[model samples]
Structure formats: C-alpha cells, structure tokens
Target: MERSHDGYDLFSPEFRADPNAHWAAMRQAGCPVAHSDKWGGSFMPVAYDDIRDIARDGARFSSRAIEVAGPLEAAGGLYLPPLTSDPPEHKPHRGVLMPYFLPARIAEFEPFVREKARKLAEELAERGGGDVVTDFAQHLTIAVLTKMLGVPPGEQFTDWMIRMIRVGPKDQAVRAEAIHEILGYLGGLLDEREVEPRDDLISYLAAADIEGEPLSRKHKIGAAFLVLIAGADTTWSAISASLWHLALHEEDRKRLVADPSLLDTTSEEFLRVYAPVSVARLATQDVELHGRSVAAGERVLLAFGAANRDPEVFEEPDKIMIDRKRNRHLTFGSGEHRCLGSNLARLELRITLEEWLRVMPDFRLVDPDGVTWSGGQTRGPERVDFEVVR
Candidate 1:
C-alpha cells in the first residue's frame, strides 16, 4: 500500500521501520527527488546509480555540513567531524585518522574483539537467551570503541561514554543537554591526555599536526565524539541486523557454520543488506541525474539502504545470499568519504559472528512484535530479544 505525496511523512515510525516499499513507490511515481522541509529541504534518492554517482563526485555534491542541516546544524561541533567536511579541509584530518583504522591496526586488536565477543556470547548462553541488540551488540561495540580510545573497558568512564554517544534523533532538548555534558567531559579527558599521552586514537589526534600546529581543543573533542558515535552506533546496528538475519535464516546459519571459510563473504553480504548509516548529501550545483534535475544547494539523501537493495545492481536484491561473489555494496559508502573504520567494523563483525554461532548455534526471536527500531539519520533495531536453545 502506498500513500499520496501529502500523506508521506519521512520521519514517521512506519517509514523508519521499512522504507524500501516507500522508496520503490516514489521511484515509480516519477518523483526521484522526494523533499522534506523537516530535514532542511533534503531530497531522498531512491535509484542505485544516482547515489553512487553522487558519492563519487564530491565536488558536485559536496558533503560539507550540508547534510546535517535543520536542527542538527545548531549543534555544530556535536555532529560527526571530518565526515561533515569536504575536499581539502576533510583531507588532513582524514589522512591522520586513516592509519589507526587500517586493516593491520584492526588485525592487532582482533584478539581483544574476539575475547569480548566470546565473553558476551558465553554470558548470553548461560542466560539461555538475550537481547542481542542491548546485551550483546551494544556492549561489544562500546567495549571495542572504548578500548581503541584507550578507555578501560567496563569502567565508569566507559559507561558514561556509551550513554553520551547513544544520543539519537529524539527530544532535541535532551539531546542538546547530553551533548553539552559530553563535550565538557571530553574536554577534561583531552586536557589529561595532553600531559600524559597514551597509545590510543585520542592521544594520536591530540598530538597530530595538521599544518605545523597541534590539533586544537575543539578539533580533539569533535574528532573524539565522531569516533565514539561512528565507531559505536553503526557497528552495533550492523552486528544486530546481521544477528537478526542469521536468526531468521537458519539455513544461512547452517551454511556458515558448515564452512567457516565463507565468513568473509558472509560478512560483506550482511553489510550489503543492512547498510546501517543512511547518510545524506547535498547538491552544490544544479545537476541532471537519470533525467531528474537537482537544483543548487538541494539536499539529496543517498538512501544507501535503498541503493544496496536496488534490483538493477543485485540479483535477487532482497534475498540474503551469504556467498555473493561480486557483492559491491555501499554500506561503508563510496569514493573519498568512504568509512575509515570499515576495516575495524569488519574485523569486529567477522569475529563476533564466528564466535557467537560457535557457542549458540540455534537461537530464535523471542517476540517479533516487541522488536523496536531507533529511527534517526542511521536506522537499526533498538532491541531484539531472542532465546538460545541450550
């Protein structure tokens, strides 16, 4: 069932739960540029090629704080740093942060990630079931992010950081209060790290020189916030979705369990289907795309989630095939602004899946109706309870 243009509410809970149907309907209606004033005049792109093209050409569709327009713009520094920037300004910081999230760096931390996953799985197994989203996924992601930032896992500081980073699209007043509190807290941490630097991403950024000068307090705080949120939320969502998929498809789980070698491909396939970060971009100048014209400064949401499921791109796009050979999904994104921490995310997901399946091979969704999704710029289940067959 499709609703008329006047009836479509982008921020509606129904839209958030399953947007693909709406996207398809919109695409068919000949209105590729679905506008929403709530998001500061942003347009949602439903086509596959258009999103890829827009992502590839940063100059034409500059990201630079253009996407986070509306209410989020006021909270300037609170938004994801470097990610909101484009080209030359985006390059220096991205370059400095790149090495830390490289595959080799993530490889070094694989043991730690595996241990966390095993412990979480073991705890859930003992309980005979658990909410994968809250108990397992969220905990695992927060643990890894805190570890990367040199924060001790399972500590008060970690707890604070996790709470601080979980701010999503909800009550603006509450979100702002949380942001202010977190910024102040992060400021103190930066000051301490300044005197006694550690071998962590935060310390590295604190000491990093963009052009003969060390990064400023705002830069450090902003970068740290971005890392915490990006590293935690998206990864947690991906893992949760992947777990949900596996639970629903026991045949897929059996296939993966039978041949552990397919882990890499399976991981990619999950990401392809469950692209967590539904990033929005803007058209810097008027551009024609697939017979549609986008005006200058017009916002275009590259429905990475929709694009991944584009029938033109993926064969049987809706189906979750674990062994997709040529799966080039835009989960991490495309072109220059592609995720820097994708390797780390992949490492964590790979290890988490391998370990979880080994311990609890048969798990069933407890109450499908009870499952809730946290709607925001990025979308994923809020709570997914399940029962493990011990």
Candidate 2:
C-alpha cells in the first residue's frame, strides 16, 4: 500500500529523505496539484500562489480537520482550538490566545528561551558532539513548552508529545493512547488551576472563556494540547533542520559565524529553505484548481514548504542565502490560520542559533549520509548527529 503521488511515493523513505527535490520535480513537470490516494485521497498544492489562495480561502478550505488522513474528527476529535477551529469559533479561540503570543508578550519569554538554548548548546559543546534533534533541539523545545504550561519539567511529557505529534498521526493505537494520556494530564492541571490559578497558559485557559461562557474542560485541555503538539515538534524540526543545514554547508555556516549580525536573515533563510509543517485543509465544495477538480471534502495538503521554494516566488529558491533580501516566505503559512506562535518561534530560533554558534561554531555532521527525517503533515530531520571540531 504505497502512498503514491504522481509517480512519487509520499510515504516512502526516499520522499521523506528529500521531499524538496521531489516537490521541485513535480513543480517543474507543470504539476501544480499532485494527487495521492493515500489517506483516503488528498491533493498537494505546490505553487506559492495556489497554496496561498487555498490557505486564505477558509470558506472553501475548512481547518476543522487538518490531517492528510482526512478530517480531525475522524481521529477521535481532540478539539485543539484555534488550529483546529474554523471561522467564528476560530476568531474567538484565536482572540483569547492572541495576547499570549503577541510580540510584546512573546518577548517576555526571551530570557527563558535564551537560558534554555545556552544550557543545551553548552551541554552539546561539552560532549564535543551529539544528535542535534534529541540532545539539543527537542530538549530545548520541550523545556520551553513545560515552562509555558507551568508544568514540572519531565521526560514523560516529551515522550508523550513526540509520540502524539510525530508517531501518533500514523498509528491509531498510539494516537488514541497518547491523546488519552495528554487529555488526562492536562485535565488534572486545569482542575488545579480552577481552584488555585497560576501565571501560566493552563491557568489562563482554565479561567478563560469564549464569548461570555467559561470554556469547557475539553476546550481547555485541547488548547493546552495544541500548545504541546504545535509548540514541540514544529520548532524542534525547524531548529534541527537549521543545524543540519549548517552542519553540511561549511561555507554558509562559516559566513554566519564570521558575521553575527547576519543571524536575523540567516534564521529566516533557514526557515524558508527548511520550512517544516505542511498543513491539510478539507475542501468545502467542488473546485477546479489548475484545471484539476477537487470535490468537496477532499483533503488538500497545503505544501507551504514547497510554496516557499517556488522559483516563481523565490529567486534561486533552493539556495540558502543568509542575506536573501525581501524574503517573504510563507513558512508561517498565510491567512487567518497562520501560525499563532510565529513570533515566539522566531525568538526561540534566533536565540537557539545565537547561543549554539557562540558555543559550538565549529560543529559539523557526524555523517552526512546518516541524518534521518520524518515526513507527513510535518517533515524534519529525526536525528542530526553533529561533532564539534576542537
């Protein structure tokens, strides 16, 4: 049962290894929308404008079920608001949570983010090398998430999140178990916050409401669950991919190292080149896209990564230009459902790179051929083994 897409197998190891190349081929072949029968049936819009339009047209593309495997409700309906909510519901959920992620509020988390990044980079430097994904990126992401949720730092949270976000999507049993565990965990925390509030997201959600009514327990847990799922792997993937890129490309890495001022552009370029997270949107009605018909209810994989790399939009799209000017890549996606955590994500990424380069500027891949990647809704290096040059 290969998840084939126009001669390419989306679920195959080869595609996961280098999806960008496959996508480039597809785009070059004049294929704007690549169809795949996997996950019941789905479409991937490769071009920038098409993806942008699809993302913006919420009426035609519902966000309620954002999985390539069809609707979110089919997967036990976890109800992660904002990300999973659509239209009117989306506005309120997004509004309530918006203040937390606003630039000013996100800046408040900078010291904490910087502290975690420094510690992780120092540990890796001390070890003279390590898997960037596990040892540094993933660890740093989970630590921040725990701090944001006001939960005690624990390895179990990391494990559960990894399973839920990465592994669970492809496995029903794992998905169900992980969802149950996460809901239960957050439910208890919500209960605690109800009586004795804290200065954390969970407490805010516990007390917060949509319109005038207080949010249901399920909604509270779902919001927190969104933070765990969205907050963990996506940033981890971006960070790991950035490190992986630098580990292989010495010249680019060296240039950034020589000029610390180039970090802002460098980070954005990395995000553009290695943009992780391709979201799914269900068609609300029959539509003709690039002369291809998409019936209502069919899932469309909004390939933002592919869109970012569209040559029509980005000159020398594949090349990672640290100082690429006017780089308005859609890595954060587009329209109303654009990533709520973009500001925070950018801060974490910049701080991660800044701190890592400060401590381990001379690091490279342990084995260029040995890096691993995971692909589906979101794609990134699963393991990026690096070795610091002494």
Candidate 3:
C-alpha cells in the first residue's frame, strides 16, 4: 500500500515474508517497472514480456555482476563461468559443462538420486515427524551435489556453502570470509584431482578444454564454485516449497497421491507458483521501458516468481490449477542464462515428491504460522515441520 521512496525495498522483512502480495500491489497500481534505491539502486520488472525481453537482450543487459545486495566475486576475481560470463565467452564456457547435464548423463544419476531420496523419506516416516527443510531437502541435495563435484560427502561441508549463499548476500564481511574459505577448500580438491585424476566433475574439469585452450586453474575453480553455489540452494528451495504446498492442501495432496502420473504437471505448477530464484543484470546502456528510465550500470532485478504469476500470461494467475492444460512459466528462466541444471533439477524434484508421497502419504504442517521463510534472491521455507496424518 505505502511505499518507501515510491519503490519497494526488497530487503525489508515484510517484502521477504510475502513478496507476492507486494507484487500484486505494484501491478494494481499499474507500475510495470518499479524502482528501488536499495542495494545501489535496482529496477524490478514484474510482467512476463518485460522480463523475457530483458533476458534475451544480452548485449544491453550484462550478466557479469549478478549480485543485488552485495558483490562477491567468484574465486576472488575470476567470473563464475557461464553463470556470470557474457557473449562469446559465455557460449564456449557453457558448452564445456553441457555434457555433464545432458539427459543421458542425468539419467545415469537417477538411480543415485532416487536411492538417496527414498532413504530420507523412510527416515522421516520412522521419526513420525521432522523439519523437512533441514532433515530432508537439504540433506538429499547436499549429498547429490557433493558426490557429483567429487568433494567430501557430509553435511559439515555444507555449513559454509549455505552461509555463503544465504547470509552473504545481505552482509559484506561475512561473504568475503566465506568466499575465501570456500576457495581454499575447493583449491585443495582441485590440486588432488590434478595429481590423481578420478571419474568425477573435478577430474573432468582438470583435463577439460575450453575451445582449443586448456582451462586455467582459476577457471576450473570458478566453474566448481558455480556448481557449489547455484546447484544446491535453487533445487532444495524448489523441493522444500513443493512439500510445503502439499502439506497445506489436502485435496491437491490426495489427488496427486491417487494418480502419481499427475506429478509431471504438478511439478511444473509448483515451480511456477513458488519460483525460487531472482537473478540480477547490469544495464549496459540507458533504456526506457514502461515510462521509466534505467541508466547504464544500474541493476535490473528479474523477479521470475512475479513474472510467472502475471495475469496476462496465465488464465488464473493466483490459483494453482494442478491440471492446467496450457502452462508456460519462466521458473527455470529464459534465454542464454536459463538454468543449466534444469534437467537435473527436474529429476530431483520429481523423485523427491514421488518418494515422499509413497512413504509419507498423509501429512500436515505441525504449525503453519511457525513456518518461517528465508529471504533475498532465492526464497523458501526455512523450516517445514510436519507429522503424519494418522
């Protein structure tokens, strides 16, 4: 209703708690592009068309600096390959990592993913109740990512990863220290892979070539950093949010449980309604859109979650129609930076839901009001405590 400086403050507790409500207010006020002075000033585009155009125009909107709250360069100075790379450099670097995420490669990882998810589900059932965020979603995602990256397989390694991503955005000193510590750990892993190559991502990167030239040491570490930072938070948020949704809606839960085949569309619907990621881009040149002027170098925040809910694109934007026939949402984003791990992310979400429903069929939130959420960039319930219906 009321705005500070005639713009939204993304870091405020209210916005983080319920961003959708804020977006609705902005839409009703007919503001397609809202300006905010927070984080060195950022412009948010809520409509689907605006977001799509900005994403496609790589020339105008540079992906070099993606951080909105603060800046933490990957591997000290080197850009995180593909994720932060732009244009020609982006293509070659992204191409190198493409093989690992291809459908065939992802299918190879399915057995491992399913086994981990199934075990977590059974453990949750045995306990009768647990915090799904920490106990289930975080554990499963960390295990898979560590195995893929050829790092030590344990939750201990995840503390820094979580802190670096979740807390680092809002705090500068913490982010710097976390980045330094992560680089040290990854550097050691890379050194080990160099001497004794193994059949893992680290070893592959050690010998992998970008175009004709071999990747530099900095390049190797930056690529690994991307997997560590991007891969874990985004997927787990999706998984945790999906479970949170099912825990609240009994009818949707029962329908999905009755006919598991609906998982395909249901997963898409969940992603659309609860899109977890919001990326940043730097405007290379001054531009005018929706009667607002964006100066060069100003950050444009792409709220994919808001774009997905635009009334113009979907018939009923607010309501989650699980069986919606024609659904086209930008949960994984669009254009060049569209998530590289989409296939892996989809596989993990589907299997997590399948195993969860199979083992813990009837469950509900232990305390809906107590379900707290994490803010900034990626948003998801921090704790989703639930118990069996029986």
Best by lDDT: 3
lDDT of 1 by residue, 30-115 (tens): 66556566645566677788788888788888675433334535433344557877777888868767788877788999888999
* Winner on lDDT (1 vs 2): 2
TM-score per candidate, chains pooled: 0.91, 0.96, 0.96
lDDT tens per residue, model 2, 1-390: 112346445567998888888888776676777787765567877889989988988888888877665333483265889888888788898988897888998899999999989988998888889899989888888888888999888888778866776776677688788889888888899889999999999889988977799988778888888988887888999999998988888998899989999999999998998888888888889998877788987778887889898889899998789999879899998989999999988998999889998998888887899877888777889898889999
Give the clashing pairs for model 1.
none
Worst 10 residues of 2 by lDDT: 1-10
User: How many angstroms is residue 39 displaced in model 1 relative to the true structure, after the best TM-score fit?
Assistant: 4.1
Q: What is the lDDT of residue 217 in candidate 1?
A: 74
* Per-candidate count of clashing residue pairs (backbone under 3 Å): 0, 1, 0
